[model samples]
Target: MEKVKVDLVVTGYVFNDKKEFLLIYHNKLNKWLPVGGHMEQNETPDEALLREVSEETGLSVEILGKSEIGMGGNVKTNLATPFHVNVHNVGDHDHCSLFYVCKAKGSGEIKLQEEEVGGFKWVKKEDLNQEFIPKDVRNIALKAFETVE
Candidate 1:
């Protein structure tokens, strides 16, 4: 087996009130994928998820799931849990991705990250079969769709 470098990454399956999923055309990967990237050091999965969504889609998102943990007196932090986790190959490396469901905060225009993303779209679940999307991505997207619906 070929040696593979593994890295932790966070992904968000952002859905609007209409239940359409957000997808982006990654320039380097040449495939339509969810909004996500490598996790930065010292950042929790929830933090990374939110950051990636905003950076790639230019939309502030509200992650779905329980955001609060009551450990004791006056200590609380809101953070979402990953709906799914998977390891996928990306060229010479693999990413252990944490997937979370999310919703857009407002009606904001998408601003693609020109360097990494080539295009973006809010697609219906049925549209996952489009040629531009990879099989694995489509599977993950389908699950995310079912999750929110």
Candidate 2:
């Protein structure tokens, strides 16, 4: 049976100290995009961001923004605020994606998940103007860079 469900996904615009952004060439999608994936059960968005970033690039990152929300009484959990949210179609299903800005913890080699990504690169802000990059991703990436500056 075909699964028709709206999946919650997270994306990160990860920048290094040099202010370059990390992008991955998704083998399945055949496009260059930020690192992210579907949120796992029982995991907060911040936790899922860390997990996805580590799994995809092998680099530890500090997600930028508030990592907690006060919901009145004694309930508090670390949940990074998404810089942007939008829904997009993914073949048979849809993905409601939360986009975040992040910074690499330290300098390190990026190890790609060969099965998922064809390649990866650290792109400068100017390079974001390239035609290959989607307009929305480019816009958000530019905003992320500006926010950190």
TM-score of 1: 0.89
Cα lDDT tens digits, model 1, 24-130, are 88898888888999899989888888888878878999888865666667765656778899898887789998899888898857877799998888888877788
Clashes (N, CA, C under 3 Å) per candidate: 1, 0
TM-score per model over all chains = 0.89, 0.90
Clash-forming residue pairs, model 1: 67-78
Q: RMSD per prediction, one decimal?
A: 2.2, 2.6
Q: Which stretches of candidate 1 lie over 4 Å from their true place?
A: 1-3, 67-69, 73-78
Question: Evaluated with TM-score, which candidate comes out highest?
Answer: 2
Model 2 TM-score, all chains together: 0.90
lDDT per residue (tens digit) for residues 32-91 in model 2 = 999999999999888999999999999999988874555766767556788889998989
